[model samples]
Target: RDEGLHPAIRIALRAITDFAIPFQKSSKLYWRYFLVPEAEFTEEAIPQITAPVIEVKKAKNEVPEIKEELQIIKTMPNEPREKIEMVISEPKKEEMLTPAAKEPLIKNPAIEKKEILPEQILDKKALKKEAKKPKPKPKKQKSDKKEEGFFNKVKERLASKSIDITDIIGIKKDELILKVKKEKKEELLIAYNKRKITEGDIIEAHKKAKEADLPYSILNLSGIPKKIQDLIEALKDISSIEKL
Candidate 1:
């Protein structure tokens, strides 16, 4: 049994030795080929990194000194100069006047020699009195003759007949003014009622007559009835009544 166990342990020891020998040899080769010399690497890297840091520190330290120099230049003073000389001028003297220059001379001999009379003295009061006097009265003007009534003409037109229907219907507002004259108003009323004259017709006639500038007095005497007159008034009051 002891000899069998011994054979297994010998085999395990041999395998382990074989692996260690190759690993050690490879490690030595890697270190010798790839790792550079410490002194040479440090010298090159130190200058590259440290040089920029030194320059930055020097610039920071010098900045305050440069600013101090600039401040000294700004605080310096300017120089003074000599005063300028001033000259003043005196005023000129005026020339003296003679007796002939001081004496007055007439511009126009004729105007200076002219004489004044008492009558030539203007009477301002008399002139004002004349102006204030009242003017003479003008004669009254004669007025134009008034237009004749339609009834007057109608009377002649209906001479033979007692009354004519056409005359009544045709009687304009102007003819109605004749009612003021000779009691003709009753005759006009009779005429208007006999014809059965409408308020609308009378209003239309009045409007036309007004447009023509016919006198109001003439329209008043026109033979239209009192009922028709009332109708005209009512028509005027009615808001919806058109001009006709």
Candidate 2:
């Protein structure tokens, strides 16, 4: 019955303040609770991916098994061959002994021990090189300035010049700022150029470019047809233009 008062707002004000919600509880319960209905996945589908096995085919000629047949055999005659006997001559006991064996071998030791290392050949050149292996010298830095005089002098010289020094001083990580010393748009009238391409392709491109809201170039109205190579001064200047 009261004027200018909503029933819900009036009922809220009449609530007990002593038993009010704590400041911490207000923040936690401020958000409305949402009850998400059980998801209906019956209409949804999951794709099944199957792996395909790839078979590699190799040519039989490429196999290296044929290289193992290193030996070649030839057929011999069926007839039995006669064997020849080598002549043997008996040399005297003194003559039979070699120059080295004559002295040492003649005087047989009480214990005939087998020679473990018969001969050892030492290379003097290799031994000398290995023995003289040089120690590595400590690496020295190219520059270790006592003061910043060199850098200060360079900066002072740059400051003296009228040219901007900030252009050169830059971190490589930053993107390069493209600066054109001289920039101007130039227009050329080529109605009289006799060697340029003037064809239906130019008209088609112009229409398409206009519809698509783009800029297009077309060389047209050449009374006499001429090849590009003829007009170019050098062979290298006549680069192959890529076709779109």
Candidate 3:
């Protein structure tokens, strides 16, 4: 006999104790009894059931085929073709007939052509006019002439004062004029002869000459000494002094 325990209560106990049971031992007991069948549950086998035999039906038969007869054709021999010949006719020439009356031949009028000469082709009068014209002469320039005159005047003035003017030719006029003003005329002439005249010497001389109401031209003649008289007489012929 079994206890009157509810299925839910038994399931709850098994759920709680499931961890305590070994899985391998539970599987061996389940396959041994629950899955295997006993000899009392076996039934006897019935006699073998037989099936009816079947027959295969045959299809309708087709008609018999006949072989076709072939006919052989023979080709006729070809005849040779003939070429046709063409005849060409030559053209006939017609003779020219003469006129009943012949006319007299007339000549054309002659043309008169003139030839032109080279002299006749050009304008002779124009050539002659150009050849007859006179050429212009160049005018003389005077600035250099004036400068030469100024230098000549300076030379004459210096020479009158017994100054050696030849050696002073290349000296600038302005510088020479300045030298004639500062120093005594004799002293300045000496310095000028020695090529040592100062600008102050010339300025003082120019001032003295101005104060005395005399021209620089007069001052140029102020320093003549008796010693240079013979020298002046000897240079007279060869000097431009004559021209001055």
Q: lDDT tens digits, residues 25-117, model 3?
A: 211211112233443222232122232222111111111111111111112234222111000011112211212112212222332235776
Question: Which regions in candidate 1 have their CA more than 4 angstroms from the true location?
Answer: 1-194, 216-227, 233-244
Clashes of 2: 0
lDDT of each: 0.38, 0.31, 0.35
| Model 2 agreement with the true structure over 1-244: per-residue lDDT tens digits | 1112332322332232222221112112111112422242221342323222221112234234323321111123442222110001111245324454323322225435666553332466567788899978764443323123434433454346432233221111211111111123222111212235544444554564566454433333343344543543455687687889
Worst 10 residues of 3 by lDDT: 83-92
Candidate 1 residue lDDT tens string, 99-190: 33233332334334567665555576678878999997774343112223344554554454443322222433333322212323222222
| Reference-based TM-score, model 2 | 0.15
Tell me each candidate's TM-score.
0.17, 0.15, 0.17
Cα lDDT for residue 116, model 2?
52
TM-score of the candidate numbered 3? 0.17
On lDDT, the leading prediction is 1
Can you tell me which runs of candidate 3 are displaced by over 4 Å? 1-141, 169-244
Task: Give model 3's clash tally.
Answer: 15
